[model samples]
Target: MAASMWRKMRTYVSRKNIHRLIFDPQCAIFSMFLLLIAEVAVNILVIKKIKYTEIDWKAYMQEVEGVVNGTYDYTKLRGDTGPLVYPAGFVYVYMALYYVTSYGHHIRLGQYVFALLYILSLVILFDIYRKTKRVPPYSFIFMCCASYRIHSIYVLRLFNDPVAMFFMYVAINFFLRDRWSIGCLMYSFGVSIKMNLLLFSPAILMLLMVRFGTLKTLLHLIVCAVPQIVLAVPFLLENPVGYVVRAFNFGRQFFYVWTVNWRLIPEEIFLNKYFQTALLILHVTFLILFFVFKWRRLYPGVGFGILMKESPTALSPNQILLPLFTSNLIGMSFSRSLHYQFYVWYFHTLHYLLWSTTQPPIVKILVLGVIELCWNTYPSTVLSSSLLHVCHAVLLYGLWYSPDYTPNDKNLTATKVD
Candidate 1:
């Protein structure tokens, strides 16, 4: 059975395709048009003056002033009190921007740089979609450019998300290419900037364990973790207790009514120490279970030595990428709290997970539509949040279960991770 599944996976990836628009030049144009549409939408928001003060842009600009003054302390941040919620690695980006221009150019400079990073991420995503040969090229582009979260990354909330996300995109791109070491290194940088980047860490662990083995995976994890530890050093030196508390404050909860998730859930549950703890335990348990099931199911009757000799899947890491992405997403989907900007974390990845499924096209469309609606709405209603949560479970469960073997399928499942 193990040999047969491996053979089946091999044949599936090797099958040929004859799609005309897969690599057509106009596909790029269509992608750009979708981005333009999102830009127009953001411009409309700018005109309304709705996003300027409330969007976190003003706060971001203030944070950079910390760099300009020679104190790199995050405690100086405006709006929010105490030390910065972001990791110290982000200071590197602001520090560079600080030397380049005057105070007046801070926000705009940050915007332009972050926008470019986001564009680069999109370009890489476009390439991944194009290579998949499983989904309509146009559909993936629409999801990428049409997202409100994507719009916010560039036009509204000017935080370190895009920069951290840029490293994630780069890491995934390298993973797709079978440069496992390089990919893991790049992933370290993303995690260093923001621990959220570690959402994909479970998937990476699975990949490393499969492609290398238990011992090598341990080594890779050490390699990946070193950077995160190093990045925290400066902040740790300034105020060890404060930095650790602020940086890894997993216990800290949010009650921002503006957030989409948990609005309908009684604030009592959100504040309930036990409920939050259960969710964290569940999150860790979920990853371990997913990893075990996948390992047993895919490599049945095979030992680690033989497994590493030849990957069961035909493609190098394509099968790994889909689940790697979705598994991490599964962690986020069940998060105790998800903020508005946090939606940016999964917008494109969820779309990719959607494409990986063998579910009916309409179902896929509705799932994406529901997720888009949930995030796009400000102060999301209970109805949309419920829909978003359900669809996330449905989409992730779909992506988590099987890598659709159909030639038209690009999504990796239990068989492949997208």
Candidate 2:
């Protein structure tokens, strides 16, 4: 029996099979299963050992309490933290949580619910990687295990960032599967929860124009807009201007103390209007370069006029995901500030973007590790902020030089959804 066991182990550990397990997309299902099991165990351990940090849970409950008690005016809601700035979707989602957890008294149960959310988000993300086949199976290990910050954001802190991101990924999945209408709807739902999802609007707009003609694209835009209007109806009826200004406050400045990305900058400069304007300019510039040059390589020599005509050519999974992910990255890279909780906004996409780059494998791994290090640093220092910027620069640089995507479909008839 000992000899038989040894032989079986040897067969499983053979070099070729191990290679296939890590390098092959076919192994993603098996890899995801094992990772998820480990994640469940980790969550259980975290809950059992780590004390849940109360950051915004109480504040969330208080804000929603106002809504529950018959307040619809966006500017009228207030909690311990500040005025209720999130949209009506946030109110609805957390209101459900409020009732489920015995009026926000049940913290552990909330953590468990978020743990489940974390798992579901991973499943959708894994599906994305499997469909794209852009990253190797081993990259999943880093995505699942490398970041303590991500786990805490979802479970311990109970920030609404993860909740908003959940819908965003769902929308991406739908878009990749060629269901544009449903995808737009889901994307709108995400935006109603928070505005960060709007970062993908530029890419999604380009995609809509390319896939459906200008007229059809406008219909899809309406699909995305209708949800926001419907969700905000009550608040809008009470105070339409307040709902627009408070819920979708684009000029809202973040506190310097909470900033994870701009700690190197002085607080005064960080608060200066010029700094914010500069960041916005840089963000728009980088996006223009990426959209016009790198992303358009899939349809070389095709002008915007022709693209608006809706060619029947199908986009590959990589073609669909690359632009969208890159758009978000550019937005995050130039963001005026990124709080610790904001890590979830771009964490899952880092692995895909890293592998999408032309950097050496070792360089890719090191960049990811440095980024993880930067995020893990509490009350981030000048050194950490600098390191984070360096890593982002490396990723952007690599993506630019990376090989152009090779479409799965050679013919223009269809992009593969399967």
User: Which candidate tops TM-score?
Assistant: 2
lDDT of 1 by residue, 121-234 (tens): 777766665555455655664565457566665555666676777788888888777677788888888876777887887777666766667766777888887877787676
Q: What does each candidate score in C-alpha RMSD? A: 9.1, 2.5
1-418 per-residue lDDT for model 2 (tens digits): 9999999999999998889888887777788889989999988788779889988999999999999999998888989999989988999999999999999999999999999999999989988888876687888889997678888998899889999999999998998788889999999999988899988889999888877778889999999999999999999999999989999999998999998899998999999999999999999999999977777776643458643776566566777777888899999999999999989999999988888877887898898899999999998999999999999999899888767544333422245434
With a 3 Å backbone cut-off (N, CA, C), the pairs that clash in candidate 2 are 314-415
Stretches of candidate 1 off by over 4 Å are 1-54, 67-82, 104-106, 295-315, 400-418
Estimate candidate 2's alpha-carbon lDDT, on a 0 to 1 scale. 0.87
Weakest 10 consecutive residues, lDDT, candidate 2? 405-414
Which candidate wins on lDDT?
A: 2
